[model samples]
Target chain A: MTNIAEKLNISEKLIATLELEKNSLAGTAHIQAIRKTALGSFTEQGLPHRKNEEYKYSPVSALFKSELCPAKQNACAKLTKSTIAELRIPGLDSHLITVVNGFVSEDLSDYNPNAKSVLVYNTRNTAKHAPALFEKHFGQYASNDADAFIALNTAAFQDVLFIQIADNVQVDKPVVILNVTTTETASLASPRNLIHVGQNASVQIIELYVSIDQNASAINNSVSEIVIETGAKALFYKIQDDCPGLNLITTTQASQKANSHFDTHTVTLSGSWIRNNLNILLEGEHCESHLNGLFILNDSQHVDNHTLVDHAKPHCESNQLYKGLLDDKSSGVFNGKIFVRRDAQKTNAYQSSKNMLLSDDAAINAKPQLEIYADDVKCSHGSSTGQIDEEALFYLKSRGIGSESAKALLMLAFTQDVVNTIRIDALRKHAETLIEKRLSK
Target chain B: MLSIKNLKAGIADKEILKGFNLEVKAGEVHAIMGPNGSGKSTLASVLAGREDYAVTEGAVQFNGKDLLDLSPEDRAREGLFLAFQYPVEIPGVSNINFLKTAIAEIRKYRGLPPMEAKDFLKLVKEKQALVELQVTLANRSVNEGFSGGEKKRNEIFQMAVLEPCLAILDETDSGLDIDALRIVANGVNKLRSENRSFVVITHYQRLLEYIVPDFVHVMYDGKIVKSGPKELALELEAKGYDWIKKELGDVIEA
Candidate 1:
């Protein structure tokens, strides 16, 4: 409390709540040292304001003004095993892990500890069981100096998940990580995760954020660090379908080794306010990356998606496509930045951002920035923002289709490119059904 | 079956179709031949309920009902179809899916139940053959990446599927080669019936050689200046539209 009391406006009350939980948090000296350093960083740099470049489109500071407390592990009393079983993607077969209020539920997870070459551990237990692994890669990629939310997550996170795959081991089924937040009062949950895929290994991961209580007012600040070794392939999916009372900020940072392939698809369906930051570093030669996103918003919801692909080595390639469909008074933002270093020759990068504002009251802001230092590289970007094509609408209507159905058909077509980028069949169909339902309304 | 009297329509402040008049009975195909910018397309657009065109004067009647009182979709449901001169390419909307939905909506408007999937597919197969449309093209997005021939043939295929009573072919022969024109005209001829009528608007008489019309009219300056038999199209084609213009000198305004 004393450390945060000396800080500036909105964040003062936040740190006071964290100070009360600090006394009860049990960890080894090594883990405590890490928390102390992170808290020091949080004290030096408070919550970001609008002046902050990365936080320009989002109101991160205003979120802390609400009367909130850290989410308790026992606050999810309304949930049971059957309660979450119905929330899973119908007919999707995968390994499931449910994290309730930032606490890993072993009873709900279908992980087999006896299986070799694969391991899953809660960060609270990693400090005691696998101290070396936890100390080595815990905060290596997600830098505390880069953003305040990362530092705050490091200092006050209750439980974290660590997933590891052995060398040359390809998992047949995907790992589904479901994060659920259920609280009786206003609360906040910070869930941190670290995933490491070894050389020549392949895996797929899906992260879903859901809220059990529709009336629960909560905020989730989540961070994930993924490390893909040489020749590894990994596909990650992030789906956000939460209650209207929830505000979420998710940051995912990845570093790829030589010849590794990494792809991520982000679908944002419903939320009050959401901001996602995706950053990937091509640290070795010939690495490839793909980042695609689709967001359908209505009501007064708001979403901002920012992405960066840093080509630190030569012969790297990346492609990005983000499309938004907004109706009513909802708003959205897309900012994509690509950086090619001096030695990163033969780099190819492409980016496109398209948006459709269904109503005049809806709006969007798009910014695409590319900084290249290499002499031999190919980079191109395109952006478009407008209403639905009236000619196409009339063409459909002239065939006897109603105006609403015609608009839905055109919107579904507009999002087809992004949807096709999803490799998983079931998840892709699920996104399509959700989008059609949203537009049909 | 259809009649237009003193029809005056235009876009914005400029009038295109000035004091137009026409009448067509069932079991007849009428060809309206004229030069470019003579309001042939404007009449087609006005009849199809294009909102961009405002009909300031005159009235249109179809089956004894006021045709101007309906929206574009209602007009479509009332058995009125327009094959666009430049067919719109709508990406990501499958041609078959669009036709299915259109048929279902039209049926719903007529107080009938939706067609079953089996019956719908059977009808699609039958219609696809009449226009020589490929199964792949029928399943692809509407008019996207289609050649000129495929686009015109697709228009006729859609007309066959919807089975409109009064079909307006608006410059369907503009961009077609000889072979495409033959195939399109053949498809239109196949759909002809005793109870259905067609208003075929073309600049060239080559399209009518395959599907002969019962009546031929010459449109100039937004009005029908002459009415005769099908031989009028051949006469205008052989001598060109200049003879009609020279004969109506000073009688027709620019």
Candidate 2:
């Protein structure tokens, strides 16, 4: 990644810009070496185009324009807590961790800086302070072989937000990583994050992406690698709402050990464009994983979610439910894959993708794939896309509920099963408010 | 008070209700008895402002207001209720929440504030007992996974809660057994008041046996062929629909 190639093989504008960002890479020598390998992979595969197998519906390359570059260092320096406070949904009591354009903004964050049970720092600093731990798992989980975007992020990311929980530490307060990408110009922010939960430790991490300065557009290609140790429990929360000029691509990879529990929820109420790739690897026995997602889009917004659950060990269970409610000309896609290894006997995996379209022009594509090499495993997947039930709507309206409230209610019901899986109570309430607002629009 | 004059309705070019007419004052329970395909349900659908049914020529005056001028929700807010023949099963909307929202919207329309939570729960409990609904069913999704009898009882329960002035029970007795029918009819009878009226549309006379109607009209080919007292339902039930067809033929020739 450090050495720039004289000639480029692909004509993608983002890939060309990535090649030019060779000398500006940050972190330690170890990360620089890994960045080299990742850059090589990205340069070889290039940006995902229209015909790319993974991006058939979401042509990620088309979003890249020559005007879009890495945002400057002092992009949101004028942003204050009061201005960002207006965007907050009420009733959230958590230790706030704010990151502006991938850089940790301490003055904007509210967490304890001297907490002994947990440590939160940018990876560049962590790479110097906690060198051993950083080298062990920094670039280990997120694969670059197939996904060019992940490699592109890894090769060009300047800073990484790192969080580590000590063994047997039960952090009561959730850490809200509020990321605001100021898009006064066409800008791009590739944020790299790593969360390591120690043995028997439990925590919740909420990654919220919101946009400001909407005169121009921005793209945030973020990658977060989570390591849940033995007997640990984690809840990964992602909420995207009221993002007017943000195009987001996120890949979250979680590796669980024996007797670990990992639950992830992704809710997208408003965004210009969004794509989420969640990959869970259950390597040890008796692991449990639950993935729930809800995306309610209108206007011309788009959101694509691709999830993969790999059951490599026996006695593991995983359940996934993703639902979408689309209106106007908005579109969405859901692709879920479950793979059960041969030795993973008694594995139980279930996935369902349910979508409802309020308008005839709105569309959705749902695909569920399951592969089981073990005979004793129980795995099933169901995908369904439908319009709002006319009978149900009439039934509601006939009861004195107006059209707007009725549609919002019905859309909330369609997403209730998935939204209910949100573990945080206040966060769940905030999500309901956000979802209802989006639906009513 | 309710009045329907020269109501003609259909579904996408296929006319069903041709020159239908009816009139009922306040507190009058009108029973519309008709055979299958006689446009009985179409009349109920059109009255409730269902978008599928287009009224090409007609006027419905309810409480001195043009009913056709209001949306279905506004009609409900104006004290019109339609108990569907086959109630829709909404999977994720709890019966209690649905009721609360309906009451809130209706109250809002009437220039009143929302009911307090304590009062709302109290009202729910009272309404549940009217239809013998279990306490658990109030928390469950609206009519979801409910038995046939339970669904009908839920409709009556909803009708009890809303307390509509003009309640249209469209074939509410079609799928009820004797015990369930008695329970549901008992709920409706308890809700009947001097200020509230009902139009019970049914094929059988068994329901009329419980909640006797003020008037029974024999409908044939989208028009009332015979109008008489409540005994007319018993006559039609015994002689079947052929008697009405023959009676209409004689009138047409005259």
RMSD of each: 2.6, 3.2
Docking class of 1: medium
Candidate with top DockQ is 2
lDDT of 1 by residue, A9-60 (tens): 4476777777767767656676577677887788788888667888787766
Clashing pairs in 2: A1-A36
Model 2 per-residue lDDT at A142: 94
Cα lDDT of all candidates, in order? 0.87, 0.86
- DockQ of prediction 1: 0.79
Displacement of the residue A354 alpha carbon in candidate 1, Å: 1.1
lDDT per residue as tens, model 2, A1-441: 211121122324556676777667667788788888888898777777666778998876446643466755575656898876775657777888887776677778888867987888776555667546667998899999859878988877878877889999999788888988875677678788889999999999898988877434567888999999999999999998867867889999999999999999999887888999999999999999999999988889899999999999999999999998888899999989999999999999999998988788898989899999999988889998888899999999999999989887888788888878888898899888887777766
Q: For candidate 2, what is the DockQ?
A: 0.87
Please write out the lDDT profile of model 1 over residues B1-254, one tens digit for every residue.
Answer: 89999999999999999999989899899999999999999999889888899999999999888999888888889999999998999998899889888999999999999999999989988988999988485558999999988998898999999999999999899889888888899899999999999999999898889889999999998999888999999899889999899889856554
Q: Residue pairs in steric clash, candidate 1?
A: none
TM-score of the A chain in candidate 2?
Answer: 0.94
Candidate 2 local lDDT, B95-153, one digit each (tens): 88899999999999999988999999888898999899884865589899998898988
Q: In each prediction, how many residue pairs overlap at the backbone (N, C-alpha, C within less than 3 A)?
A: 0, 1
DockQ, all candidates in order:
0.79, 0.87
